[model samples]
Target: RDLHNRGGERFIYNLRAEPATPEFELHGKYYYAQLAPGTRMIWFVNLSRQNGFTGPVELKVEGLPEGVTATPVTIPSGLTRAAVILSAKTGAKIDARLVRLYGKAVYSDATGKPRDLVRYAHVTCELQVSGGSQARRPINTQIVGVTNPLDIVEFEATPSKITLRPGEKVEIKVRVKRNKEFTGPIQLAMPFLYGNSIIADQLPPGVTMSSDSKARLTGKTVEGTIVLEAATGDSAPKPLERFPIAVMGRISMSFSISTNYASNPIHLTILGADSKAAR
Candidate 1:
């Protein structure tokens, strides 16, 4: 006899038998089991009837392997049982297998042999495992516009043109915008030449460029001035004083204009030269 519960609180069966004697009654037992990685089974026997009236009764159960070990079992209040199969242990390697678990009971009568009382049930669990690696990846940049002081109106040099004997000296001032909004440093590159004849190459005597290397056009940009002294050669006393002196000659001046950015170079040139007498 096989019993099952599909929906309600009742046991449904497939086989029913009637015994002739009052001593020949049917008995049923329930069992529960778990499936993992080992081998196990269960068996049932009928001890209620002792004598007579017996024909050859064949019991065949499908869905079960042939090589299984059977043991008589019992279940508590609410539980089920099934056949469990397991794999042999191999060092560091994982073992994997499947098993079917269900509830089993025994049914027996005087005329018929003992049969399996089976019920279907379910099992719930979780699986887990562990180890593995991870990589790094790069970034890009761009540019914009330029601004100077308002007070620094224009750049002017004395004797707009200068002619040097050899060691003669000249002075120039770069006029700046007033009340400007510059807080960062400014770098000026002054290039001086003797009217395309010979490049002054060196700075003038007494007059020094901004010590800041990079001058700061801070506060109000009011007529910021840069004074430069030009010295002529020692031999040429008069030095023909009538050449040109240019400020910010073709050379480039570069520095950081802000706390966060760098300023593109502002190129200035001394176009002509002149001497003290010419001025």
Candidate 2:
């Protein structure tokens, strides 16, 4: 059944399925995990890119060594990572084996129809004595896991929305909020780009965020602003549109610890040459 409610210029149409297939890519061919018997460990399956797939996903591990079991993981809608918990019995076998990983993307289609997409990965599972080191395997790459320090920092930008025309310029301020009772270092980062309905370090130029290649944390909290200039004359890429904003950076407590972190993207509405925002 379908529902089409007649409304002003913006009517509602309940789609039963998606117009096209949504895509989400999972990277990493193998994973390395080791833990003591009766103990548990956490790992992750990283995503190389998410192609407009805004839905929930489920992940599971299979073929682990005897006495070791994996608790399935489910990624909520709009998130790009999944964490799996591996637990070993007190008397579990101490051995090494190849295991299989699985992922299923679940979501609703445009027509409100339920749908699912699936993917598979391979992992080299190892069970060993607690605190013991095992020889690194060939496929043990991709340094993303559960214990990243950069994951805890917070970020925000001021004057989130701005209006600009050809040859116009503006200044936007960004701030990094840190956790209470703790002070270390935080940095801000984002590609120098303007498009895709989001503007970061482009437009007015004169960006003052120090290192755009790698935003290193300098203090427990940080704040800065950048100049953005709109294209002028005949080379303007956009006439009038609203774009969102996002910033990325790294956080580290010590020289040996660091991870990547990004701010929650926000929208920026632009009113210029031929924007349809007013309608």
Candidate 3:
């Protein structure tokens, strides 16, 4: 450069590192619903990653009105989507408003230091009136309210809890009580979703849902069994470990959409292979 400048010629060189951040975005068909008293609605959220982010994302709903509650859910690592279920109390009053849906995750930055990152859903959500099936109008805010009768009034799992040895297989009977208006077929399964490809079971490592159990309820049928088996070998969770599992009842809204309702959680305890059940 000095030689070139002396000869009336000029040149320049710039050096810098590529810029990046540990972050991601949340995407989904926003929580657009008018839940009624004694009803539930499920919101599905997918992740759009950036900067090579990889980890489970913890989800929360903010600005929900009184008498309405959201289930605690986490999008497992390597999975792209997770369901957020909102339930209204049997006596919830009429209310409506815009709400926020966001996700939080932890990742190590380029310096190897852990950092917390948060992101919100990119699109607006609309909370329509019950049975309001009309052409959608574009909007800019997320909405959810409590107002009309809906499906899946009550869903419960028998025994409430379970205890078993490694390699033991147990049966959990789930009963769905729905409003008189909804008598169509419903599918019951675990809550974990791997995009639209499959519905994965959310259980401890080595524990799995048995294929022999029935998962579909057609017509007047309201009860189904979910059998879980624990592996006897290395895959089983350690003795004394406990895991919480819920039965999810899904009603298809379309070929790609569904409304899911959850049952009361069941506490599952793993017993030692040669030992008696823990008290």
Candidate 4:
């Protein structure tokens, strides 16, 4: 008997069955199942030997929550590969199954049924808040891009980020303190440009230097200011693009005396609109 049967009667009969035909046979199966939020999945099938399987196949997945959509699945011209992107909303978890249904065979059986395949992947993400309370709060964290924390470099200064209208001048003061003690004839040089041009040295028309003779080289003390004047133009000067300046030199030094000294760069800004309108 091709089929087996069980019975308690004296005489019993069994039914016969045959194996599935080649035309109705399924080739192979694969699946891309559970995925995390903002994740992707891919699927493919191999059909190199089958000559009649030359058409598109329908792909579908179920159990996905609301607000989630699946991408269209298509088989390439010469290759049997398909891809899809599965994006999930924030604070969402994805867990689902995929089902692939094969179309009717071109040659014989005309029997097409769906095959089940299971696959899974997971993802975890941390939220980042920008310019919010969490960002404003201080936390213990190490800096990544800096090498030297403490390195002595030359002194430099630039205009602050504050906005300056046309004809407006800003004053910036840079102070430099000497690390070692020395005494000699020093010359103080300041860059001619600060924010806006000096207008032929008119911004601070009155540039002067003052210091106490005792503090010159004897390590006593000295104080002074370098003043510049801005030129009066038909209209206020355009917004300052770049301002550069440097101060160097020793005015005087005493005999057998070493002193530590420092210099300050002072900048004064004039509002040409106010001054010009006033004039």
Clashes of each: 50, 16, 1, 21
| Distance from true location, Cα of 81 in model 4, Å | 2.9
Badly placed stretches (over 4 Å) of model 4 are 1-32, 47-51, 76-78, 91-279
Locate the minimum summed-lDDT window of 10 residues in model 2: 199-208
lDDT of 4 by residue, 49-108 (tens): 243444434333445555345454433223332223233333444334333333222223
lDDT string, candidate 3, 74-153, tens digits: 66565566557677888899999788888989999778999998887765333444564423333446788877666777
Best by lDDT: 3
Given candidate 3, what's the lDDT at residue 266? 70
Please list the Cα RMSD from the true structure of every candidate, rounded to 1 decimal place: 46.9, 16.9, 10.6, 31.7
- Provide TM-scores for the models: 0.24, 0.36, 0.61, 0.24
Candidate 1 residues 138-213, lDDT tens each?
1111011122222222333333443332333433444433224433333333422223332222222222344333
Candidates 2 and 4: which is better by lDDT? Answer: 2
Cα-based lDDT for every prediction: 0.27, 0.49, 0.71, 0.29
Q: What is the lDDT, from 0 to 100, of the residue 222 in candidate 4?
A: 27
Which prediction has the highest TM-score against the true structure? 3
Compute the lDDT of residue 123 as modeled in candidate 4. 15
* Model 3: pairs clashing at backbone N, Cα or C within 3 Å: 125-141
Which is better, 1 or 3, measured by TM-score? 3
- How much is the lDDT of residue 107 in candidate 3? 95
Off-target runs (Cα >4 Å) in candidate 1 are: 1-159, 162-165, 178-180, 192-216, 230-245, 249-278
* Candidate 3 lDDT score relative to the true structure: 0.71
